[model samples]
Target: MAESCSEAGLAPPPELARLAEGLTDQARLDGVVGLRPGRGGRRAAVLILIEVGLDGPAILFLKRSRQLRHHAGQIAFPGGGVDPTDVDLVAAALREAEEETGLDRSGVTVLGVSPAAHVAVSGFDVSAVVGWWHAPSPVAAVDPREVETVRMIPVAELTEPRNRARVRHPSGYTGPAFRIDDWLIWGLTAHFVDGILELGGWARPWDESRTVEIPERYLTDRRDTSGDVNAH
Candidate 1:
């Protein structure tokens, strides 16, 4: 397959292009959390795949399969715990993307990585690798056991007041949330998405006063399951 940006008519979005032009390594170190300096927790990596769509630039997300033991039925980036054979975080992210979304790694341009964020629930430190899909590929749920559906959420739709809200956790933690159709994206996924939008300077002012509760069912079920202590 001819995997080239020109062949696919794909180009980086304006905001991303600007960031890439002015981007410094220090940008990844800013505003990151749970920075466990040592290496005790499991290592994991996720790809933040951005592409220029008809409406504009959008990000790719996945709805995890409900049948999974951990973080079931949750919205997450396509990633998992890094295997011993994985060379680095970027390789792990790309491998997981290919496994979960059928995304061709060759079609993606490595933009860099964000600081390591700890997922306390899974006891894993995840590094999010930001990438531009210069040569787009057909993305779908390659594994029914891991992925439920694939979504390319437009940046504009996410920043809209009607779709934005704050999700309150039972633990009294509050963070950004987005309502995309029937799916409610909250937790770590929402936090990462919110940060990325701001970093790209593509975020718009929305009513932050709007609030919603993270579904009790999700919280309760996760507590009962042995998957992980926290919902990633």
Candidate 2:
């Protein structure tokens, strides 16, 4: 099956099937929680957008524009603080995905939601709403002010040992990191992706000895929560 797809340049690799199956296991959902929200915390959610690419399973990520008041120039999942009119976390995630990436909900198959995680810098209790883009659609940075770029990153490439490293902040905080196709995936986004790869059994052995400190210029302007929380 993998060989035929590689030849045809159409179907995804066989691992995509395993990924879809792994995502639905109830036990796997428990491993995704991050920081916990504080009392009277703001609510938020993110869509773990998944799709089968020509090679294997892929994930969608967004680059926030430099103009944004919060998390400017950061790579993050499509999500935001909840709006007053939204009914729940899932709705908020879907709404933000549509607004940020021009994704139509009808083409997406929502698998399930993971436990809510907290973003202390943003003060949001975020839930990961895992979804499969069964019928993939054209997506872009619909709102230029919010999103700078939209990318569908192949899981196989991400698992490459050379592409993995650790990112350290000046505040002495350190965590898993990934550098793929010119984008540096770190902070909360890196942790979230790492958890999914582990639970889905797609993770590969990588050298953890290699570490890169986040640039002081990057940290100087953003919320100084590097020691307390991974800023989203």
Candidate 3:
């Protein structure tokens, strides 16, 4: 079961109050990607850390090291598979965030957990643990072997029409994507971003026709003999 810090009188900051409230209902999240619990896949959790930024609310993301065997050089939330020591998904999310991004868990206030979404390529039932970075702290890629860079991207930039588009994979999968300079946010990460924008009323209309093929660099290790790609 998901834990709730709201009962402890820990409310999200004003900037995220609306989004925190919207996430309480599974239906609201379902609109994102029809989220639900996975039946048989391995379990994992990701921390969706939001903080007030100079322009507005921003989300933290990490670029995985290219040297890693899985999801190499991909942008992702700080998280991993649940460890045996983890008390629950929330604990696992916080622990992974701290390990991957040097995040100070003490500064985060858990709002709630979203319905789990299964990634077919990785075979992990991933749950998103939404939290507010009430007390911001300095963070960086702690280990070069696992993480290459840490970034806090403002939601405003993501919602900009020109920054939004659709991405088509070699597997014939097409989905929403966000462009941040050279980085292309797609796959499961982009789906979550799309949902968050809708939940927070931050989404803007963009040309869905503006579709692009997944970059070759990101697809190097993603494709198989059948021409299918992996989700990041």
lDDT per residue for candidate 2 within 1-232, as digits (tens), equals 0112223344333555555465567666555554343345566678888887667789999888878655577778898767898877778888888988988876676655667666655566666777677678899999898789999998887899998999877666677888886688887778778878887688999888998766443575355332222364
| Model 1 per-residue lDDT tens digits across residues 1-232 | 2222344565556758754542344654456443233146777778889888778888899988888866677888887667888888888888888988999898887665766676555667677777888778999999888789998988888887799998877766677899988878887677677767777777788889999867655674233234331254
Candidate 3 off by > 4 Å: 1-8, 35-37, 220-232
lDDT of 1 at 164: 90
Q: Candidate 2 vs. truth: CA RMSD?
A: 6.6
What is the lDDT of every predicted structure here? 0.73, 0.72, 0.78
By TM-score, the candidates rank as 3, 1, 2
To one decimal, what is the Cα RMSD in angstroms of model 1 from the true structure?
A: 4.0
Highest-TM-score candidate: 3
Q: Which candidate model has the greater TM-score, 2 or 3?
A: 3
Clashing pairs in 3: none
After superposition on all C-alphas, the RMSD of every candidate to the true structure, in Å, is 4.0, 6.6, 3.5
- Runs in model 1 with CA error above 4 Å? 1-13, 21-28, 32-40, 221-230
Per-model TM-score versus the true fold: 0.85, 0.82, 0.89
User: Can you write out model 3's per-residue Cα lDDT over 54-97, one digit (the tens) per residue?
Assistant: 67899998887888765677888888788999999899999988
